[model samples]
Each structure stands twice: as C-alpha cells, then as structure tokens.
Target chain A: MSALLYLVTHKLKNRVREIFHRPSELVLLLIGAALVVFVVFTGNLDVDPGAVRPRAELSAIIFALYALVFVLTAKNGFVNGASMFSMADVNLLFTGPNKEKTLLSYGLFSQMGRSLMLGLFILYQYSWVHRAYGVTLTDLVILLVGYGMTAFLGQMLAMLLYSFTSGSDSRVRLAKGVFYGVIGAFVLYFAFLVLRAPEGELLPKVLAAAASPVLHFFPVAGFVRLGTVGAMELHASHIAIGLGCFAGCLILYYILISVLDMDFYEDVLKATEVSFSAITARKEGKAQEQAPRNVKVGKTGLGKGFGASVIAQKHRVENRRGKVLLLDLTSVVMAVVTVAFAFFTKQPVGALVMSMYLMIMTIGTGRWAKELLLPYVYLIPEPPFRKLLYMLREQLPALLMQSAVTFIPLYFLLHCDPLTVAAFILARTSAGWLFIGVDLLLHRWFGAGSNKALLLMFYFLFCSLSCVPGAAFAVVLFQILFIPLSVSVLAMAALNLLLALLLLFLSRNVLSASESNNQ
Target chain B: MLQVNHVTKKYGKLTANRDVSFQIGDGEIAVLLGPNGAGKSTIIKCIAGLLRFEGEILLDGFVNKTLDAKKRLGYVPEMPAIYDMLTVGEHLEFMLRAYKMEDDGTADRLLERFELLDKKNKLGKELSKGMQQKLSLCCALVHRPSVIIFDEPMVGLDPHAIKQLKEVFLELRQSGASVLISTHMIDSVEAYWDKAYIMKDGAFVAERSASDTTEASLEDLFFALTEGGADA
Candidate 1:
C-alpha cells in the first residue's frame, strides 16, 4: 500500500515537474485555465441574472436534455469493453501484494483524472448549455458537479457490469433489461409528449413533461437530477438525496464486485496492451489510435494490391470488420442521431456538427496514420512518395465513404439549395484532406517528441490556415465577379484542392524525415 | 557481407552507441553480447538502417539506407511489431508485397518449421507472445535477405521455436548470409557464434573469435569486461 501510494505521489510529482520543464505545455495549461476562469468569473457562462425561471414548458424540455445526457453516459458505460485498470496499474499493482479493496481504491482514484478532464469539457460547454437550457450560475456549477459524478459513476458501473455479467446468463439478461428499461422510458416519454400536447404546440408540452417528477425513477437519470434539482428549486433534500444515491451506488458496486468472483486478468491485460500500444503509437506520431475493437477473426487476408499491399493490408483489416461497420457502429449511430437531431430541431448546424465530428473521426488530429511506427514501412522497397500516396489513397476513399454515409441523409432532411448541399459534402470531404495536410505539416516541422497539447493547438491552427487562403480568394472573387454563392463554393474547392496538392508536395519528405528520426 | 564503421548514435546528449564498429562476412555468425543499456540494440538499429548514425554502414557494398540495401536486409526487432488486426498469413503476404517479391513457399516453409502453420488463421493480437515472436521471425526470413539481424529472438519462444531458430541461424550461415544477433544470454549463442563482441557503456570492450587463443568462455570474458575488472 505504501509502495502504491509512493508510486502515485512520485508519478504526480514527475508530471508536475515535466509540465514545468516543457514551457509549451505549461503555457497551454495556463491559457486554458485562464480561459475557463475568465468565462466562469465574468458570469457569462450563466443565464442572464435578470432572467426569471423558465416556464414549466421550457424547464421540462431542458430536463429532457439532461435526461438525454444521463442515459447516453449509462449506455456508453454499458457498451464500452475496456476495464478501468490501466496497463501500468496492471503491471505494477496487480502483481503486487495488495488486496482487491486496494485495487478498487486505486481504480476509483485513477478515475479522478478522467473526472477532472470531463469537468473541464463541461466548463467549455458551459455557455451554450447555460443558454440552451436556461441554467443559472449556481445551476451550472451544480450541473458540472453532477456531470463529473455521472462520469465517475459511469466508469464504476462499467467496471461492475463488466465483472458481474461476464459469462453469466441471468446477469446478462438483467443488464439488457435495465438498459432497455432506461431507454424505453425516454421513448415512452416522447410518445406521451406527442399525444398530450395541444394541437400545433409541441415544444411547450415536451418541455413541461421534462420537469415532471416521472424522470426521478430512472437510475442514472434520477441520480443526476438529484444533484441539480436543489439549485433549480432551493430544496435541501435534493442535495441529500443526490449524495445518498451516489453513496448507495458506490456501496452497491463494491458489494457486487465482492460477490461477482471474476478473474479479470485477461480482460485487464488486453486493455492494458491496447492502451500501451496506443501510447507508443502516440509517441511515434502514429495518430489514428482508437479504442480496440473486438474484431471477429475469420478469413482475414491481404487479398491483393498494386505493389502497395501495405495499404491493402490495412484495408483488409478494416474489411474484416464488415463493410457497414468498417467506420464503426458508434460513428454510424452518432450520424443517425445527428440526422434525427436536425429533423427535430430543424437546424442546419446539426449537419455541420456531424460533419465536424466525422472530420475528427477521419482525420484523427494527432494520428499521422501509423506510417512511422512500424518498421516494415521503412524497410519496404517502394519509393517513399509512392508509399505515402498509397497510404493516402486508402484514407481518402475511407473519408469519402464516411462522408457518403453521414451526408446522404442530410440532403433529404435539410430543404436547402441543392448546390449548397453539394458544397457541404465537398467541403466536408475537403476538410478531412486539409486536416491530414496540416497533420503531415506538423510532423514535418516538429517531429514526434512535440508536446501533444501544443501540437494539437498548432494542428487546428494549420487546418484553419489552410482554409483561410481559399476562403479569402472566394470572398475576393465573389466581390469582383458577382458570382453565385455556389460558384464561390466551387472556387473554395479549387483553392482547397490546390492547398492539398501544395501540402502533399511540401511534406512529401515526411517519410524520410520520420525514418531518420525513428532511427 | 555487412560492415558497420565508426557507427555513433546519439539521442540528444546521450550517446547510445558510440564509435561501434564491427563486420560479419558471408557465412559468419556474429553475436553482440551486452548487458541491458549496453547499446547493442542501438547499433543493430543503426545497421538495420532504422536510425541515423554519424558513420557509414554498408550492406553487401550498398549504402545501408538505400532501397536496394533495405531490400537485401532483414531485421527482427527486439519487441515483435505485430499488426494486431492481421492474421499470421496476411502478415507474410504484406511483407512479400512490400518487398515486391512473389510467394516462393518460403513463408509457408518457415511457418511450418516454427510450428506456426496451424496458427495462421489467428489474428496477431490473439497470438501469445511466443507465437508473435515466431511469426515475426517467419516474416523476417520470408524475404530471404543476404544480411539478417535478430534482436533478442529467443526471449519469448517455445523451446521448439528456439531450437528451430538455432537451426535457421546455422542454415543462414551455411547459405553464406551474414547474421548479427544481439542478445544478453551468453550461453544460448555460445555454441553457434563464430565471433562475439562484448559491449559495455556503448562500446565494444572485447572481440573474440572461436579460433582465438583465449581459453575463457564468452560469459567469463563478458563479465570480465563489464563488471569484474574496472578498466582504467
């Protein structure tokens, strides 16, 4: 126990020391903290102080959003396959003389870092959520606390469920029942909202339904509401109830773990190995590292390639995942949800948000596509540029595939201009290429040892920069030529294409430079 | 067939491999015997053309980093670089395609020899560490390079795989291929090495050939240079 404590402290101290040593990372942290602090203190990230409590209609709707978020967390916890035990802990603490209690302690304590990260993200989302949901400063703070707690509970639930349900028939069925019951509540609520609302006045009834006490019965939804219900209504029992529920959950999870009798070594090891590989890949600038999927292995082979089987090999691996699922079911589900959101909210930005999401998924800001990590690449007899082109050839088509699946739905739902629709698709596709260009540029300039935060900052900066020249040219052309906006979109596309070619030309030596550095 | 001359590798202020020079002629098996952090892997990497070095390394008279040199050189890295998604058979196919070579049944032969033919359907992630090592060796040997480097090849292997590896090394030497093996286990390679270079603090302290007059085994000589005697 002492040794584990010492390890924890030593790691923390080393991290702080490392941060101080790297001024780039230190500055990045400071700036981010400053921004959060600035936003919170100025009271801008709250609903207008002069504003009154929203009507029953609006409160209900806002509560629906909260419930939506809660259910998503619980569902995510249920589905994600990884155990909370990291590779380092598995290597160190699992083999150590600690009891399961100590191991659980370590796992929960480790979750604090993730909670802190989520809290920061919540802080980032504070302003929009404040307006959209009409939450006060106190309400926002409570919600942040609730969100952090929810995230922690989600992790604990994932661990517990993973252990408890492993190879158990009844438990698996019960788990299925609980998940469906949670989701079914929302579906039933939506249906009721539709039936109960006055003719042609849907939003108000939906909002009213959200504030109903009916939501306080669902497990995560109920628990999270308790955390914030106090701030919304000045009731003291809400806080007590929320605290009691969370505490109860913790105790129940511990008891469940005690009773489960699971030998989770293999699960922990698989996760640890994947995470370790991910970290190594990150260090080597192989950015597209993802959550390891349980790929059903059957008939896997590099069927063929045009002297570029390196690319073919990757495609083969993806193909084993099945064509529809190659982009991942989560991504496809998110796309569907986005379309549903657009249909309901009647907002075009939903599509844009989905596009941005897909861009991040495809581009993987940090991952430069595993070209440098594996040695066989450097050992390959092909020309560096040809190898690079083949790699891009694989990704560009993948980006197109992802775009087609995500965007094809938006055309029907968004009743906008047809050329505008085309522009969005082309522009989103171009964004993925542009992001890759920026990524390659960052690697060419900084190498793999570059601070991740600072590198990410510069990466987004470069992506924005790539678009600037084209956007500027489009604007100038629009003013001079009096062209239609669709033509401007075409102009933008031309410049983006030019930028893509230029970036490829400039960073063509990425392979050779990375090879030299890797040595 | 492989020559490394004055190879110096530096990572920032730390010189991992300093002025490391050695040669292995065709039909010769050279062993790099060193303790952990003795820079054996660094030099092996330098020779493998994976790292930039201050000095020259030539593979069969070709500059080490050239496509031609890379084509003729095979390296099994210390840690097996297995693609988690690829099956054993796909890994070999990928290697063959990368080298622009046709399948000559070499992959199958090597897999059969290593007893890995049965596990060809398994994904790299599903394979145990020993299997991954054997698979790595199979991929490295499939290309049939003129020069080969193995880093800790025997670490995570079944006894059978280890025995097969030893047989492969002998066969490689017999076929006139220069082989460099970096390992900390002194006795494992003692029976097979024609020459051994004992390393300490990133430099070779002693070089001995089987025909040398020194009566001490490689272990005794290694300890003498690394720990027993304090060099002035």
Candidate 2:
C-alpha cells in the first residue's frame, strides 16, 4: 500500500511538472492567480451599502468563472498531444507487470495536482477576505475546506459530463439542446430582472428553494451556506451541515474513481471518430449526388487552339468542385440561429452585429477565404480580375442566403420595418464580407495562423467602435454637416470595402512577385 | 520535358541545393542519386513548384513557378502527402476535385492496379508505410500529368511494393510522362532508369546515360560521384 501510494504521488508530481512546462499552462496559472487576487481585494475593499449580509452575487460570479476554467482545462486534458488515459495506453499498461489498480490510481491522481492548485488558490483568497470581514477562525477554516471540496466536485462533474456525452450522438444532441435551453432561460430571467425589478426580487427566494439539495449536499453550496451562516451569524447547525457536505463530496469522488472503467477512454475516441465520419459522409454524399459532372466544351473546335488547349489542359487537371449550395446552406443556418438568439434574448442591435462579426470571423472568414481566395490567386490559372469575378459569382448565393436569414428573422421577430431590416442585413453582410476579404489578404501576406492575435485585437476594436452610442454620435455629426446618416454608413461600408480590396491587391502582387523571384 | 537551370536553395546559411541543373525529356526516367541532406529532394521540390528556388526551372517550356506549369506536374514527397483524417477514397476524390477531373474510374483503376482497392475506405493513418506510399503514388498518378517528380519515393516501401512501383514508372514513361525520381535506392533503379544524375554537396557531380554505363552499374557510379572522385 505504501509503494502504491508512492507511485501515485510520483506520477502526480511528474504530471504537474509537465503541465507547468507548457506555455499555455503557465499563462493560465498566472491569469488564475491574478483573477483570484482581483476578486478578493475588490470584494474586501468595496463594501456595498445597505448590505446586512455578505455579497452572494460576487461569490456566484467567482464560482461561474471557476466553472468556465474547469470546462476549458478539462477539454484540453491531453498530455503532449496524447490523451492522458487512452485505450491504447491502457492496453500497453495491461501488458506490463504493473497491476491494473496501480495504473488506474496513477491516472486518477495525475489529474488531481492542477485541481488542487486551483482549489487552494481560491480557498486562500476567500479565506483572506472572510478573515478581513470579521468572520470567526472556525468558520473561515470551514469555508476554505468547502472551497477545496467545491473545486474537486467541479472537476469531477466536468469529467462525468464528458464521459456521459462520449460516443453517444443522441446524448450529445440532447446535451446541446439542454445547454442552449438553460442559456435561453437565463437570458429571459436577466431580461425580467432588467424590465421588472419587483418581479426580480422574487428570484432569490426561488433560487434559495431550488438550491436546498445543493445546500445540503453540493460542495460549492457548502461554501455558499458557510458564507450565509457567517453573514447572518447563524447557529452551529449550518456550519455542521457545510462540513458534512464537504465530507460527502470527498467520499463521492473516491467512489467515482473506484468505479471508473476503460469504456470511458474508448468512448472519447469513438466520439471523435463518429464526428469525423458524419462530416465525411455528408460531404461525400452531397458532392457525389448533386454536383454537375460536365460543362459544354466550346463548339468552335479550336481543338489545337491555344485557349482551347488551355481549357482542355485545365479540364484534365483534377478539380474538386462542389455545389455552392453547401456553403450557402451553412451561412443561412448560422445567420438564422444568430438572429433568433439575438431577438429572443432582446439583445440590442449592436450585440447582434458583434455576434455576427464573431461568426464570420471564425467560420466564414477562415473557410471561405481558404477555399475562394487562396485557390483563385495562388492555385488557379486565371487573370486577377477574372478570379475576382469568379469569387463574386461563387459567393453570391451564400450572400443572398445569409441576407434572407438575417432579414426575415429580424423583421418577424423584432417587428422592424422591411426596409430597415434589409438595410441592416445588407450593412452587416457587407461588413462580414469585407472582414473575410481582409482576413484572407492578411493570411496570404503574413502566412496562415500568424495574424490570429492581431485579428482578435481588431475584432475587439471594431466591436467597440460599432456600438450604438458610437453610431449615434456619428449620425449626429453627419446631421450637423447636413449629410444623411445613411450616406455616412454607406461611406463607412465603402471605406471598409476599399481597404479590403487594397489589401487583396497588395497580397496578390507580393505573393506573385515572390513566386516569380523564387523561380 | 522538365529542365532545372542553375537552381539553388538555401535555408538560412546552409545551402540545401546549390547551382544544380538537370533535364528530363518526355518518356525518359531520370533518377537523382544522393545521400540524405544532399539536396536531391530540394531539386525535386523546386521542379515540382512546391518550393521557391534561386534559379530557373521550366515545365514543357513554361516557367516552373506558374500554376499552369504546376498543373502539368505531379509530385510525391518523401513523407506521405496525405490527410490523416481522409480515407483513401476521400483523398482520391479531393485530388479529382483539385485537378477538376470528372468522376471517371481513373482513381478506382489506380487503386485496383496498386492492390489498394480493398483498403480504399480506410483512413491514411490506418495504413502501413508501404501502403501509404502506394496511396501517395496513386494520388500523384491519378491526374496523369505530363511531368512527374518524386522525392525518396521508395523509402518506406516493401520489396514487392518497390518492384510494383518500378513497373508503374515504366508504364507512366510509356504513356509519355517525363519522370524525375530522387531516391537512395540506386541498385534497384539501376536497370530501370534511362539516365541518372548523382548529386553531392548540392550539386550534380555526375550524369550518365544507361547506354554509356552498361558495365559500371548505378551503385558504382553513385558512390564514385558522391565520394568526390568525379571531377564535375
């Protein structure tokens, strides 16, 4: 038993050392530490007025951030580009003289170091704040213990969620639906809070009642219960219950590890395979069935004609052409989802624009630019203008499809004027297209994946500048000069388009010249 | 026809290919013999238009850097140039799309010829190195371009696969494709190639026609050229 314990600790230490060596891990640790410090210092320094109780709101915010971190770290759980506990690794381990339980213990303990670090940091900061707020030493200790328990519970829950969703297409779909539904419900609740403060007052009671089981059993709830006890100066019963919750969480964690199976690793691998298979199936089916096979050859049999031979030569080259409808369909579906989410959530138009920007930046820009721009400029045999014309023709269907999705949803859901909706969609789509063009040009000039940070910075800047207040101020400035706000918007759109075109020209010329010089 | 004119490539201060020049006519099989890091692959890549070089290369009289020039060129890199996520069939389909080829049975026929038809649905990562090399050759040949450039094409092949590949090269040459193969497999390619260029220190040290070196053998000629015994 002592040897087994030693093996587990050694493995855990090695895992921690490996994680610390990674650049991303270092960055995350620093960010986590800074965030903890900020929350603690702010919570302690800024005392809210008329607050007879400690701020549960601030604790909820911190916990939410911790949950986000938990999700991200769990998703990126691979070590050195390999899964920590893959089926193949398990099989290899089984072949060795080491016992299965020992290997299992090592795997389980490997994940504990990072969780322990995050838990200790949160607990330490919260304890500092609690002590400063005149909490008793016993209560502070209980809160710290509760925080550690909560962090462990969060990691376990994340892993369990991953395990449950693995290799189950229907379960994944259901999980996504439930997740979206919960987010929608939260948005609705926030909207109610904003619009009807009196009704919002009833939310805490509802939440407290809903949180009863959590208060009794959940580790995070134990921390919250401790906070409530400290603030209200409650009896010893509450403190006892909080301690009981922490103990229960520890027991549950051990039980979970004991029951874990090889199926969990197999399921994760299968999930990846299934997802890729689905994509491949869809692409193959569509391309094979729908795409046209032939184009009419020019009748004037310039059979040996230079242009004809060029055309013949091009025809001989294997071109992977699919129907433009696939991309159009994707754009339409994405736009519809964005508009629906925005309208139902009652987000301002600016928020809708920002969401559209993010969508286009990630999905549309990367893919469309890779497919349309790179191929035309660098791969295909055509004049630059002709290539540009081909790109416009190819992308028109997708543009119209996205426009219809955006306009129809906004008109119906927001009760906006048809013309206004049209203008809005046009403006947003134009901006998106311009952004895609710019991204393509940047990618070509700087090399792919190089300007990701720069693009992100630009996105944030664009979002800030395109807010309602900024737009309104611009409109007022234009009106003072007796110019129409519509004209200014058009001018802004044109400017963006011009900038995109300029970048395109510069990239094309530079790449072409470089290629020529290399030759 | 493919021609490399005083071509040189450098990565930082280390020269990969220096003032290397060679030519392969239609229906000719020209092998580039070199040790590792001797710039044979660099010359092949430059000819294939996959890399930028200091000098000039021409594919059938057109400059090598153009997409039009590349359209007539087929390349098989030393490492299997295949998407791991894509199956053999999907890879074939993607090649067909890139080359703008109609959905003919050309890819299927190539697979059948290479005995890879049964494994066409398997992902490239699932295949053995020999099978992967065969798949790479199939993708390269599926388009039937006029010029073919291969870099270390026999590195990971079984003896049988290597023999089969030699037969494929003969077949491709018969079909009028100019072939330039870079490989360390001098002994195997000895009887197959019409002409050979032995490179050392980023330059071609010897060029010998099959007719001229009937008794000497390619391995002897290769060692002679790279061992600094030949005077350019």
Candidate 3:
C-alpha cells in the first residue's frame, strides 16, 4: 500500500510538472491565482457591517459551488476523454496483483486535486473575510478531510451512475432527464425561499434543516458549522457538532468505497454493449419496414441522379438529416428546461430570452452542427457555396423544429403576449443564425469534435461576460440614438442575415483551402 | 496449457463463434487462420477471458471463467490499445502498477529487445503504427503471464517488427507459455507454428499440425477451408 501510494504520488507529480511546463497553462494559472488572491485580500479588508452572517452565506455558496463542480465534472469528460473513472489506468490496476483497496484509494486521490484546489480557494476566501471565523489548524484539517470524503462519495456515485447508464442510450437519456429535473426542483425551491424571505433574513430554514444533519456529522458540514459558530462566537457545542459531522462523513465515505460492487469497473466497460444493441435493433426494425419499396426505386433514381448533376445536391442534403435532428434535440431539450424553470420562478421574460439565446447558441456552435456541415463535400461535385447553401437548406427542418419546441413551451406555459413572443423568436433566430455562422467560421479553421465543443464553451463564456458591452450597445441603439423598435429590429435582422451570408461564403473558401492543402 | 472446449460467443443475432474448440499445450505456438469476420479474433478474446463464452476455456485445467483464471492470461487486442497521452515508459509503468509487477528491468529489457528503448519517452500517439503495435506487445508481455493471446497482432508491423515478433514468440514458447496468434499474416509465421486452425463462417473447419504435414502451409489450408464450397 505504501509503495502504491508512492507510485501514485510520483505519477501525480509528473502530471503537475507537465501542466506547469506548458507556457500557456503556466500563464493562465498565474493569472487565476492573482485574481483569486486579489479577490480574497481586497474583499477581506473592506468588510461590511451589515454582513454579520457572512460565514454562513459563504458556506452556502461554497456548498452550491461544490455541487456545480460535481455536476459539470461528471457531465464533461475530465480525467480521460471518456469519464473520470474510465481512465485505462484503473482497468490496468484492477487486472494487476495490487490490492483493490489500494488501487481505489490511489485512483480517488489522484483525481481529487482540482476539486481540492477549488475547495481551498473558497475556504480561504470565506475565512479571510470573516476574521472571527478564521480557520484554526483543526478547522483546516477538518475542511480538508471533509472535502476529500465528499469528493470520493461524489466520484463513487458518478461511477455507479455510469455503470448503469453508460452503454444504454435509453437509460442515459432517462438518467439525464431525472438529473435535470432534480436540479430544476432545487433551483425552484431556492428561488421560492428567496422570494418569500424578509429583508436581512434570506437564509431559509430548509437550508439550515438540510445542513443540520451534515453539520452534526459530516466533516464538510462540520467545517461550515465551525466557521459559522466561530463567526457568531457561539458555544463549544459548535466545535463538537462540527467534529461529529466530519467523523460521520468519513465513515460514510469508507462504507461507500469499500462496500460497493467490485465488478463496477467491468460493468462500466460492458455498458456500451447495451447502447449498441439498442441502436442495432432500431436500425433492423427500420430496415425491415423501409427496405423493399425504397430499395427497388431509390437505388435506381440515386444512380441516375449521380450520373447527372441535378440530384447529386439533394442526396447530400438528405444525408445530413440524422445529424441535424441530433443537434436540434439537444438544443431544444436544454432550452425548454432552462425556460420552463425560469417561467415557474415567475421570471418569465428572463426565462424566455435566456432560453431563446441558449437555443441559438447551442444549435449554431455545437458539435452537431460542425459534424453535419463540415464533412460531406468529398462525395459531391458542386461549387462550395452552393453545397453549403444546400446543406443549410437541409438543416432548415431541424432549425424550425428547435424553434417550435422552445417557443411553444414558453408561450403556452407563461401565456406570453404576441409581441413579446415575436420579439423573442426573431431575436433568437437571428442570434442562432449569427452563432451558426461564427461556428462555421471557427470549424472551418480549427476542425471539429471535442475541440469544437471546447471552443464553443469558451465562446459562450466570453459572450456571457461581455453582456455589459452588448447591453450598452443595445441601450445606445434603442434609447440614446432613439431608433424605432421596427427600424431597430429590421436593421439588427439585416445585419445578422448579412453576417450569416458573409460567414457562409468565408467558410466555403476555408473548406476549399483545406481540401486543396490535403490534395 | 490452454484448452478451449466447445466455446461459443454471440453478439445479439450474429453469432461470432459457434461451438469452437481447440487446445495448445505449454511450449506450443498455435496460429488461428481466417478471413475477415471468421470468428478467429472472437475465439482468441474468449480464451483470454475478455469476452464471456457459452462453453469453457481452461488454462492448465483451471477453467478461465473467473478473474483469477484471467490473471494468468495476456491479451493483445487487434487495435493498438494504449493511452495516447501516456509515454511508452509511462505505459509500461502503469502496466506494472496494475499487474503489481515489481519495477524490475523486465519492461526495460523488452523495450531494448524490441528496439523501442530510445522511443520510451514518446507518447503512444506520437509513435508510428508499427511502433504502437510493438508497444502494445510489450505491455501484454511485461507481466509475463502463462498464456498470451494475440488478435491480429501483426496488423501494422513492418517486416523487421514481424521478424522480431517471430523471435519473441519463439522465446515465449521456450519459456513454456502457450501462444495463440490470430492473424492474416499466416504465410510469414507458418513455418514457426506448431499447430494451426482454419475458421470459416463461425466455426473451425480444419486443423493442421506441422508435425503431421511439414509440407502443408497455413495459407493453402486456410484458403482450402474458407473457400466457398469447402466442407466443414
């Protein structure tokens, strides 16, 4: 076990060294560290008298951030290109003569660094701002232990979920739906509590109730309680409660890690078989129904069309339908959920606008669009612009489908007015087209797959931060410049349309360049 | 010794292997010959305990249906299966950690033997196809299991790699480990193999022994058996 620990540490050190060695990464790390330090020290020095419950508020924020990290890390491929637990090293260790417990410990510890860094940052910031609740040595120890335990628990839970849903498309879809539903409910509940709360008493009793059990037994909860009590100068019982919570959380983590199925790793590996079977079965059923009639006439027509130039373009368009549907569905579902949650919380306008914006962004720049639009030119003989226009025409149904799915739910659920609905749809459609154009431009230059996803995520993040600039622009056009609503809308629409056309043209040229380079 | 007894594997409605049985004793090198989709690789994977089969595979009379039995067997998949981000040295280190092999000079010796010593620090993705194949072979052999199963192991190997692999198999045979290699490069390794099985559709149709007929080549036997009108 000691030797195994040593190996894990060595591997981790090597990984960290590799990360730090990269100039770009080093710069980013330095910038992030500087920002975090600036935020902590500056914020700590200027303490507000009214923020008496700063510790508790910070604790709640930390807990929420932890949950967000869990969801995002689990949803996105973190350690490996597949999942956190899907790293080949785990499988290799399992097959080796090493003790399973030792391997599990190493695996869990190896992946906990990023989570720990984030946790420590939050802990330090909270501790600094609330000097009365400054972390004692014992509190820091308890915080570290609690963070590690919770991370392990979260990892195990994610692995268990992957084991059951990884290979089963239907199951994965169902699981994702349930996960989204739970998150939605939590958000709604929190919003309700906030809206109902009196001024200076925004903390819900439910949050306290939720924290009590953990505060009484889990280390993470215990640390929060310690900080909160320390800040309040509460009795010694606060420390006792925090210690008890920490101990309980450790015990639970041990039980989960030790008692879980040993074959879980194997099960995760075999899960993809289920999805493959489901897809194959669906394909077979479709084939049986469509085979005879379509086979006889379609092949002849296709061959004749190929011989001539007339039908060549349509065939290319038809080939992209599946990909379009896939992208559209992902966008629509995310949009509907985001919007529906906003509507239920009585923020109907915000929900409508955000949903429309998200829908446009998701469809325009996502992996689905890149996969559909970028790859099929090799089989077709046409002007690159013509081919792209044909491809966009093929994607029209999917675009319409996405719009309807997003718009109908908002309109019906919120009883939105026609003008608001029109404004929302038109704005979203233009935004969507503009985004798709941007995505096409990026993809034409950078290539596709997960790289494209990463780029899109970064683009969205930047756009979100630049909302101030966007809002200022909107304000200038609408209020200061006194542009009429109709005129503004038409101008914005025309600008978006022109941008889309120009981008499409540029994308075609880029593709042509790439093809020539390949040749 | 490895014993495959009436083992069958199915993927939904498609049967990859059907009632296939074969045996290779210690010090014996057996080649599985087949065309594409001939269930050769399926049988190899089943023997290696990577895939569940209907019948039984026994390694030295111990049925390899459990993890314990599997630990004694080494499997090289058809593809070059190694983490792209990991260097050749790191890949070996991981294998050592996973298999609980001591950090001795065994892996290093294999690297030198395969002429991969210089490229040990290169990532798997940076390696040429042939180099990747060699790396994979080294990973499978690093733990030194009693039985080694190769599924199209020579797919991307250069002539030099092929020669080195042949030598490696001979060394493994001398070490008393049973070897089962499934490959289309039958003609190249034909002279070294002790026994060969020819598969067609989903079953082994013919078996040949070098001891029985030294003149008969695996390619001729494989073609004769998998040909359209050939009888099982």
Q: Which candidate is the best by TM-score?
A: 1
Worst 10 residues of 1 chain A by lDDT: A284-293
Clashing pairs in 1: A60-A207, A60-A211, A61-A207, A287-A367, A287-A368, A288-A367, A519-B50, A519-B51
Candidate 1 residue A484 Cα shift, in angstroms, is 4.5
Query: Over all chains combined, what TM-score does candidate 3 have?
Result: 0.46
By DockQ, the best candidate is: 1
What C-alpha lDDT do the candidate models reach, one value each?
0.71, 0.56, 0.57
Is 2 or 3 the stronger prediction by DockQ?
A: 2
Worst 10 residues of 3 chain A by lDDT: A285-294
Whole-structure CA lDDT of model 2: 0.56
> Model 2: how far is A188 from its true place, Å?
12
Residue-pair clashes per prediction, in order, are 8, 12, 8
lDDT of 2 by residue, A76-172 (tens): 2221111335444455554567654466456555545545554554443453345334343444445444444455555554455455555567866
* C-alpha lDDT (0 to 100) for residue A325 of candidate 3: 38
Give the top-scoring candidate (lDDT). 1
Model 3 over residues B103-207: C-alpha lDDT tens digits? 679999989988899987665556887898899898888878888888888888887878888998999999999999988877778778998888888898888
Compared with the true structure, what per-residue lDDT tens digits does model 1 show for residues A1-519? Answer: 488688779988999998899888799999888867776666465366466334453344335445555555545434443456677788878887878777777777877577656666557555544554565567666766776676677666666666656556788789879877767876798678668877765545655556567666666656566556665677778778878888888788767765665455654566567667667755543433342446677566676773654665565464554342336655565566556555545565446555554455347522236555667766776676777777676566666666666666766766657776666557666767777877776766774345668777777667767777777776777788888765776677777777888888777866653432343
